[model samples]
Target: MTKWKAVIFGFILAVMVKSFFAQYEFVGLLIVGFITGYLAHDGAIGGMWNAAVAGALGTIVCAILFIIIATLGGSLFGIFGGLTGFTLSGITSITVIIGYLIYYAIVMGITGAFGGALASKK
Candidate 1:
């Protein structure tokens, strides 16, 4: 495959993987995919295989980061609300959780992809 093809394929694959991990973070995934495409084009990895590996690593890293951030944020927010004696409706609670997940995706995905690129030198 040509260089361009490898880049495109790797980007798409990266986006798909990111989306699978976090359904509500499609835009985040797309941004990461674009970054991976740039890295692939720059020969940071080598080809599609390397790009795929990098992308997968990036997704895993971001997933872990997001999980941690979201869980902690949610728990902390809940605790604060409880301390203040704020009663949250079911829908409100759900919305808060989903909102945390969205924040996690954006922060984690971008940082993780850059981290993956930095750590991977093949």
Candidate 2:
């Protein structure tokens, strides 16, 4: 229950923060991870895993949203409208997005783990 709550809270906060201050996204993600970890505290090990998953989930959700928005905009406007604004398509674009997802997952997961470790109840 606590873990789920933390995950939902973290996800919501992640979206809300990104919607407003899109520039400082990493910082907001870290803060959300920390708060989620702190809220879902169990033991160091459990907390770390839960928090890391929550953080990664947030990143995945954000990436999905980005893809959706970019696809819609690119289709309507005849351009790739994502962060990179690349015109690349097919395998190359897939590779880029996959790489981005992996990178973001690791980065966000690490921050969450650190937070969980520090805030562990046991």
Candidate 3:
């Protein structure tokens, strides 16, 4: 499979896994990294880089989706408004989301690289 396809597939898999087993979110991410690394493995291309790219992309997609869902849910349920009655502002929410995106990219990227390297051995 192509890199983009692998990224998409990994993202979907991660989301499904997280939804079903919220406590094992890291395991889902690790699985996604492994799958992407396996799929992108080529004798010429480095598996680590491929897997890292896939992980980063997948995590970014997840972050975006999460932000969208949170925004909708907050609007519909007024969830954000009840938070100490301080009300979460748009800037604060955006900042938090961006921080999470970076955190996910770095953490998941390393995991993916490791998985890709392992897959490359065989």
Candidate 4:
């Protein structure tokens, strides 16, 4: 297939996957993006390792962003008296972090697979 087709198809796949998971889980969109990217490209064992590293980085970034946004949202609600209070603690905190990690990992893995394939001439 042409490079343009691969990119377009990858993007569509990413968006669809993102849409499907976003409602059910957080960080779905980014995960989908990573997966789309990885799948669209090419790689090897070393590439997988690179993907894992990238995935971890992506997860951390998403998790941090989520936490910040969530915290800000909660604070805003509290200020508006829409909510009494919101906080991440213990299991809730852990779960959120882990969820982000998993989502990113899946995304990275998928993207890496695609990337690896694309990178190869044959």
Candidate number achieving the greatest TM-score relative to the actual structure: 2
Residues 1-122 of candidate 1: C-alpha lDDT, one tens digit per residue: 23455345554555455557556555554455445535544433333333444455455555555445544455456545443433344445556555644543444345444534554555
Task: Identify the runs in model 1 with alpha carbons over 4 angstroms from their true place.
Answer: 1-46, 76-122
Cα deviation of 110 in candidate 4 (Å)?
A: 3.9
Clashes of each: 1, 0, 0, 17
Residues 19-110 of candidate 2 have per-residue lDDT tens digits of 78779977877777677667666544555555566655666677677667766666445444543454345446667556655654455556
Model 1 poorest 10 in a row by lDDT: 41-50
RMSD list, candidates in order: 11.7, 4.3, 4.4, 7.1
Cα lDDT for residue 9, model 2?
80
Model 2 spans with C-alpha error above 4 angstroms: 75-90
- Residue pairs in steric clash, candidate 2? none
Judged by whole-model lDDT over C-alpha atoms, candidate 2 comes out at 0.64
Best by lDDT: 2
Which pairs of residues clash in candidate 1, taking residues 3 or more apart in a chain or in different chains? 45-122
Model 4 earns a TM-score of 0.48
- At residue 120, candidate 4 shows an lDDT of 53
